[model samples]
Target: MTLHQLRIFWAVAHARSFTKASKVLGLAQPSLSQQISKLEDDVGTQLFNRNRNELELTDAGIFLSRKAELILSSVDETLVGLKEFAEGTRGVIAVGALSSIARILLPRAMHRLSAEFPEVEVDIHETAPAEALELLYGRRLTMAILATDSIASSSVSFHQTEVFSDPYVLAVPRGIDLAQVNDVEADLAEPDRAVVNSTIQFNFGSQHKRRIEAWYQKVLPHYRVIGQTRTYEVALSMVQEGLGVAVVPALTACVGADQSYDVTLYRTSLPDRRLVALTPSQYVRVEPFASCLRHLRETGDDIALPHIEPGPPLMKAL
Candidate 1:
């Protein structure tokens, strides 16, 4: 079938509404219907089933949509590559990053890439750690920055360049009296304290709850934990609101002039987490992109840890 037909089919499958897909594709509803009908005729199967108000992809449609996405993505990449080749200088690089890295590392990296390799067009996609890994495997992303805790699939090779690492810090509300509190015990002792009251108001998940429990049981057996949250920002916001103390990665809770809230960062004995830059083994040999990565390892201070040493130099195989 024609590329146009595949495009129409894919859009319809994704939006699950013929009319909605028509609006997105900027085509008349009739024309969109005709395209899908023709594609289904050519494939000799129905692609979707229409319920009263919703559309569901049939088994065949689900399979075809996956392949269509790859085909379109490949075509787009090829066009970008050809354009870069014709320019005879820097190449196009597609980089993916987690939200945390996008906020802290990407802006600086983009500025440096533009200044040093003006001709190389850089496209940055911000997504979750798991999603970034999927895009990397699909060849949609040339490289990515993600948490070290995330598992890299077999299709991807880990370069292990540490981008940022920071130890967890205990953040308490600005006006809280910690003089009497030796550890978590003193903090937890005043369950009726404003901080503890605030902590009980917020929801704490299993992982964070475990951390709080461990802190009380091992680190400070007498201290009581009233609340916890997965989001670092949320915990910080709570601290600002006179809520209970929160334990968060130091990199995420750094305070500056822009911060209006009153909070203090206390060094904690918890284990630190590392953020790593991951690249396809094939692209590691590409000098321009590799150089940018090297610079980050050497100079990025978004995280509180020491500068990350570059891993074994990339061997050029191209």
Candidate 2:
């Protein structure tokens, strides 16, 4: 019934165990059990069915869990709003972003933000979209910048603003021409053409992964995946070493020094990866976060990608 009890129950439900939830909340297990018992006694209905080692939420527990999320979220927002009256634009804003994308965007954005508001501090977590979304939901991150395609469908609600859009490009070894070579088997020389047929693929589960696979199958019919990685840097590094080619976003190759990659990029017909900043609606209007988001948008707009060549007709067919 109490807000404290509701928070304990919510944490226990999500963690699925009082012991685990105790560790997460930095509270004693005995205290958590006592609180939950008090809450269940007050409600006059069993919320959780204690099964030997595992905890299962009852029908009522399931219902209350959903409501508890909303109530706690609203309460957090109220606190944030109240604190803003005293702090104004001086506070820490923890952000989660893809490592490759963050390198290109955050530098310029943080520079502008610092120049305007010296008291604002940005805590950046370079992570994949799935992990970023998790951190956002757990209240560990103030905002998350992610590619829409990379994130799985989720029930959690967030206010999203499109920050960057860049086309997927074919990363090949430098000096290997794909401009006029439609047929991979016949166009390029032996041992070298083999590299083009060998793909360094992205290893991840998402809607985007399927699309990338389908594109490869359609364009490079004879291609075989020789390497796989979850990070763009690894995939691009494999391509740079002449290990194999990869289909990656243009910005992935443009991170830091363009020459450091030592790979040539060719355009792809696949849809562009749309990057967006996801935040709770309440945080959108809060200071430091508001100015931080503005600078991110400005930096995204001013982005200039490295040189990319046009793919051959067959690669562009899709």
Candidate 3:
């Protein structure tokens, strides 16, 4: 019934192990158990069943766990709001972002926010773009950075700011000879040049795959994609081993010098991809989240976004 008990219950439900919850809460196992026991008694339900080395939530436990998570999250947000109010600063901002943007934008934004508004605590969640939008809609995330091309719903208001634009570029190995060309432009233009056999890697559940498939349909109709992997690093490694050529986002192709393969960047006639910041219409008018969005829009050129666009479509995949 108390916030302390709810916290313990939520942690146990999330971790599915009392011992793990104890470690996370920095409490002894016995103390954690006693607190959970009191909560169960007050609720008049047996929340968990101990089934030979496993903890399973009972029906009532499952029901309470969801409610408890919402309660605790709201309390946490309220406390952050109060703290910010007391300090005379913008309140806390909760942001969700795609993995690609998380790699480059989040770190720099966090650093800048800390320097400029130390009182504002910026919490970031990194996940697929689709999940980030769901969180934003549920009011769990105050804002998000997502792909502009992927935005589907009219209900969710977004302040679109172009963070980075990367043209699709082909990554090929060092020694390969295109039959009819000496340079990138010539290679792209050559009618007799062989289409390099390549494997395309992408996050399995990304919107970017559609764009990529569309690109292939239009340009490389005869070429065979030998493989597909989930991450850019894996795809890049495969390309480095001379497995095949890949069309990757230009930013991700900027690998460090330590990588042992030669990479060639080429211009593609494919449409350029863009990264944008999204938020609810109401939040756009708020102070802290608004300021953060403004800062990102103003300084987007400096941030590097992943080649893949963030977010899932509003309609379910058939």
Candidate 4:
């Protein structure tokens, strides 16, 4: 009957468990149970079939779940329209992005969003690309910035824009000899045997792991991975000790005297990593989402930077 109850029901249905939904909604489990119980009583039907393995929604619940999504989206759209008409901008826009992307891109993007529409508030949620896409489709997020290849979706209708391409670079210790061996055949013929004996690996998934392994086999021949990490910065630190060469995304592999990553970068034949900004197809017409996306495409390099100038632009989005 009430919007709050319907919202709670939608969350529970999406998550498939009262416990998870309660945590997401920031409410006590007992309170959520009571609210759901009251909602069911008001509706005069049982909404879910609670069992040990999982919380399964009943027939009525399933139908309502789909309808609830449209209802909530329409409500949000109307509110956005009201804010745009009255205040000449939006009220609030929720966005999700991977940590790596967020650290680099959100700074400039949020800066432009605020500069263009002072009253528009943007909420930044740090998440993986897959999770961010889930949030976007669930009507919880307006848009997400994700690597084009990092997307784990098979079939999801959405609109995306290619923002930029980041090259993959080989990170070797400053003392390594590959820095001068630009010719692949020559490097393979007379590589620093010591460099091939020790390698650093940063694998995010099985596919990425295979890709890295394949590249290593092609270039480093019988190379050994001396250290392993999930992040480029850590792998780079290992490279600093002459452990082994690391292949990483260029965005994280950029080198500078002040950057503290004391490694030499070499161009690789590995495919470049492409990044994209995406929104659910339904929200493409939303002004707030469209405007926020413009900030990224227009100032992508500034937004995708790992760090920012001195001052408040570094602050996380509200």
Name the top lDDT candidate: 2
Selected candidate, larger lDDT, 2 vs 4: 2
Better of 1 and 3 by TM-score: 3
Q: What lDDT tens digits, residue by residue, belong to model 2 across residues 12-75?
A: 8866788767765668999999999999999999999999897899999999988988888898
Rank by TM-score (best first): 2, 4, 3, 1
Sum up the clashes in candidate 4: 1
Tens-place lDDT per residue, model 4, 1-318, is 898888888877766677877766777889988888999999999999999877889999988877887787678667666666784544677878765567666666778878767877878898766566656645577777877777665314457877667777777677655434433344534345566457888767677889888877766566777788866777877888777778877677544323436667666666888878777555567666677777777766543322311211111111
The 10-residue segment with the lowest total lDDT in model 2? 149-158
| Model 3 superposed RMSD (Cα) | 9.0
Provide the overall lDDT of each model, using Cα atoms, as 2-decimal numbers.
0.61, 0.83, 0.63, 0.69
Candidate 2 deviant stretches above 4 angstroms: 1-59, 87-90, 257-260
Candidate 4: regions farther than 4 A off: 9-20, 29-65, 88-90, 130-140, 154-158, 179-199, 217-230, 254-260, 280-283, 301-318
Off by over 4 Å in 1: 1-84, 88-92, 152-156, 177-180, 183-213, 216-230, 255-261, 301-318
Tell me the TM-score of each prediction against the true structure: 0.58, 0.85, 0.58, 0.69
Task: Summarize candidate 3's per-residue lDDT along 1-318 as a digit string, tens digits.
Answer: 898888788767755677766765667989988998999899898999977666789999989877875676567556645655565655668887755466556666677767677778877887666656655544567777876666765424445655667776666655554433433334553332343534465754456777677665545555667888755656767777777767766666644322223555455656776877776555565556666776776556664433332211210121
lDDT tens digits, residues 151-259, model 1? 4444234455676777765666765544344344334455435453344211333454576456535533334445555456666787777756666666555443233
Instruction: Give me the displacement of residue 181 in model 3, in angstroms.
Output: 3.5
